[model samples]
Target: MATETPTSGSADGYYDFHDHDDAAHLHALGYQSEFKRDMSPWANFSLGFTYLSPVVGVYTVFAFALATGGPPMIWAFVLAGLGQLMVALIFSEVVAQFPVAGGVYPWARRLWGRKYAWMTGWVYIIALLVTISSVVYGAGPFIASVFGFTPSVDTTIACALGLLVLATIINFMGTSVLAKAAIIGFTAELVGALVVGAWLLIAHREQSITVLFDTFGTEGDSGSYLPAFAAAALIGVYQYYGFEACGDVAEEVKDPGRLIPKAMRQTIYIGGAAATFVCLALVLSVTDIGAVVSGEVTDPVSAVLEEAFGTVGARAVLVIVLLSFLSCAMSLQAAASRLLYSYGRDDMIMGSSLLKKFSPTRHIPPYALVVSAIVPAIIVIGSRVSENAITKIISFATLGMYLGFQMVILAALRARLKGWVPSGKYTLGAWGLPVNIIALVYGVIAMVNMAWPRTPDAAWYDNWIVALSGVIVVAVGLVYMAIHPLHDRSTAPYDDAIPKK
Candidate 1:
């Protein structure tokens, strides 16, 4: 592995190295100071926020939720928000203790061992890459809507590829540009959510608040609203993620141990609020809620927005949504590249040397960034063969992330049971054990909810794809690990990074 002597301070003193505090912390955890630490607290927060991307998350899945469970689906946001807050809290505890890039991968490694960490990283990296594809594909129609063009499969694929290329360029520009773009995207999404939501509530609302409780007779095969509601809850499940992006870029953020945990919580708090408000506003503004539930109007959010605002007004909103999509793709790519870099830095993967190479001038992992972009672009192109490409791709992303999350949380729980105690500045104190258990429960429930085959009338693949895909991903990772075990396990020494009392 390449090594650099830890410097005492930056020339301008902008970094205030303080006896190489950050470098020391990283070295204690078996890593060198490879990434440039330019991210401020807000920048770190912005990366997580943009990855969550309320506008993109809600807009992309809005119509599907409305069609599945009608106005009552809005409550899914509330339930999901509470559930995910538990997961985020658990994440904060681990991230504060480890404060490593690649998020769950390194966390699991420290808590468990090499095999667990390998699977965690493998699943997470795949999820992050596919999430880039999902976000780009989700944005395609909004871009088309803004330009007044019809979104056919051909057009959507073209738009998705264009987005992948643009986001890759921003990532290659390095952390500073990525941070600035995240802040810009966050501002647009926040402002758009508040302004659009308030307008829809004040000027366009045609339904009562009570409307959110009505299922409109859309129950599942069991003839119970419970099953359909579980399926519809996917909207909220999908949105609350991406907060882990903060941990993925931990090495790039200043004072990460102190700041990343707070940033993770804030991402969920702010994102959950914005998403709930916007989804509620859209549901309430619908003139004919039955039409939406019955699939008479497939894209209910757009239909309502066009009706509430005039054509020009709706087009303006579409532009804001498009920006959110662009930023979402950018953040996903950035996080994925960092995960690749982390795996490579530890010599865990096949192309460690190349993947771990940092561009001296750019101070970023150029090859990893390129691989990140290419994989997602290929996924987008290949998805064109599927009739329900968007839904299935989104399912893959949500399932993959949940599986990765559960693995890390489970590892942490086991470690805790075995007398592990957090040594970070932000330990959860007396609440750690309870929170970790609850978080694991929520993760399991959410994963099953997302992977459950809900569409009985659709083709078998459409129904079972999420569960089957998840199994296939796990199997592939295990096969690779069995054939080619990691070259070195010396980093296991750093397990002492979290000292036992």
Candidate 2:
């Protein structure tokens, strides 16, 4: 990485944050948000699209819809998938411009102002924690099912907390360390998803393609044709979420302005196509929904494999999934830590002085990683009280992530409309206006689907206990702000100069 360079005066130009951050800016007494750029553009892109991308996001709802919404689940997936493209385009626009660590927050900050940026940042932060809870909570049964080793809820919580701790350590080691592990873990997740998908496709070659593509039908507790189909598309939307991770880590890439946008476009196309193929393989492979959903079969992909292959064969696949998901949890925790580190530098948390303490030797935000682990550890404990509540909370919390995503699009739109930033190395330029409008429309629709309460049996309403946390966290942020007036010029949420953070 290059050394820090001071401010440059433009003889003829107006104001703008410098196009890049200096690595030496990271060396400070209590602040360390700077990241070393070492990732290849491909790794940068796939890491987001691969690991934390939710398979359950696709499966949980669509599975529920299978019975009633006979074949139209494909349509749901199709439309929702298209909706995601709107958000993805927005990100393509932003990362091409500001390529900073504070993705949605930065864009919102640059567009709306500091206060709004902080609110968006906090919402995204809590949302990330809630998703962490869901991912860990869901991973538990897979561990037990594959190993035939059972543990009480309390023990499961401990294991989950331990995993959180491990991830915290890995992430705190440094951006390079975290990024390297992500590459390996991402490769595993990609291979695992494909191998299982391919096996199912080959085994179920006899099923009619028309069963999936021919028509749409209502399955299970799904209400009406159009609404249920709308809800089902949501499943695919969830699975493909998180590819914007490429944008958040752009500051850590060698030539973020160029590479980030390239990765952004490729990640979506590659990840989207891969997921489409997997879903096709999966729906075709299923012989009976009744047998699959009968038990606590959380790892449905593995379950399908087991049905096709023998018990021993399926168990091996289950092991692969268990390991893969565990790594995903680790990767997500790392991202959460860095995001919190950025927030801390911006004085979003109390004792802002402490949270940004970077390790001199390791080049990491140790305190920020520690802070990131605390809420999640508590969440892991809370999960024991009610597994269903935890899962619902995570799902509901994901809406904040969706909100963050929308802001990124909003930022890109603002940049194009206002023409305030530098001419970015990459751009939507002319297409920016139309793309942002479509993205905003789709974002609103998806949020409503998530917000709309469904029947108690429907996945939307099924785990609602956890979903309310988004409101709770936002309310908490307000209360916290009231107590400690929000002023931290040293770590201004936006406004370049890299803050004093």
Candidate 3:
């Protein structure tokens, strides 16, 4: 166990080196300190919050949710919030024990074995890269609107690339700069959400709170509204992730076993509340709920913002939103690069030497960061090949992440059943088994709902894109593993992978 030392403050609120104790902990875990441990508790929490940015999540998916499930879609936030909160709990306990960089990958590696970890990381890293493209591409319209350009497909793509570049540059500056930017983004986003949601509810609410139960007949030709509600749950599914970002840089955080768990929980709780509040405000303030349900108001979130705050104020809010998007992308980029670094360190992938290289001054993986940026840039550029390419691919982002998360949850459950007790700064104790079971069940159900084909009139591929994407990604990963046998080469510890009876 690592003993906590007194934290000494610096000018930027980051702590000085007070804990060789943390370094000893890393050594005990079979790793050395290569990254700077400069992240304060607030910075750690901010990174998780920015990764799970409510503004980015709510603004990006609000219209779709409203159109797909009408005013009742707001309840999806409640369902997802509770469900993901359970996932956060499961993750917190695991991360408290592992506190390893690469989040799910290392957790899965220790909980199961390198083979399971490889698949989990492969699915997760691809999902994170695609999510970067999806988010920045989603931000294109907001960036265009802020710059007075008409929001079109072309302009959105171009602006998204530009934002991606900016985020990449920020990430290259090292952990301190990234932490500061995340703190700023978190403050702006949380404050802006509260202020905007309160204003809309108090000054511009056009419907009663009772409207939440009204579906406005979004069931379409379906027999039950449950189908439509399930489809609309995408918004909440997308919103609640990114909390795992906190654990992805475990080495860069001081006293991580204790801090990272709290950060993850804080992210799910605070980020989920912000998302639900904002979604509720937008739902209540919709000028025409029927129109939104009918798809006549395709951009209901912007409509509410524009109508309530007018053009100037809405543009200002766009600036804040742009910051949130940029912060979210940067955080994702950081997470991806750290996972790559962890893989490299373990010789779990090709080009292990280069991928594992850390900058002496920055204490960051420059090569891995570059790879992260380049892959997402390729994903964005490739997305333009079809008009709906990014849209179809983005559908897989949430589902892919859910799959990765559930893999860890399942591994943890397997470990528990094998008598693996969580011994860390934080543990659920008597509640661990029940919490783990519920989290896994909820995750699997959510995965099914997310991947279910809902669009009957669409192409077979389009309707099944989410599940198809997961299958393709997993298939490719399995092929690579079979050919290369990389997991067998991993140098990481796996004492937690107890043999089956």
Candidate 1: worst 10 consecutive residues by lDDT? 1-10
lDDT of 2 by residue, 331-371 (tens): 56666666766666666667767765667677666876776
Give the alpha carbon lDDT tens digit for every residue of 1-501 in model 1.
111122222221112223437777676655677788988899899999999999888998988888887778878887878878877877777776677888888888888777878899899899889999999998888788888999999999999999889999999898989999999999989877899999999999999999888888889456789887887877988898989999999988877767888899899899989999999888889899888888888888778889988899999988888888989899998889888888888889898889989998778899899999999999999988998799889888999998998998898888888877665556677788898898899899889888888778988877899999999999999889888888345353334423356
| Candidate 3 per-residue lDDT over residues 411-438, each given as its tens digit | 9898889977666666777788888898
- Write down the TM-score of every candidate: 0.94, 0.84, 0.94
Best by lDDT: 3
Please give the RMSD of candidate 1 to the true structure.
5.2
RMSD of 2: 5.4
Q: What's the candidate order when arranged by decreasing lDDT?
A: 3, 1, 2
Which regions of candidate 2 fall more than 4 Å away from where they truly are? 1-34, 51-71, 150-159, 213-223, 290-300, 411-422, 456-468, 488-501
Superposed on all Cα atoms, the candidates' RMSDs to the truth, in angstroms, are 5.2, 5.4, 4.9
Ranking by TM-score: 3, 1, 2
**Deviating ranges (above 4 Å) for candidate 3:** 1-20, 497-501
Residue 311 error for model 2, in Å? Answer: 2.5
As a TM-score, model 1 comes out at 0.94
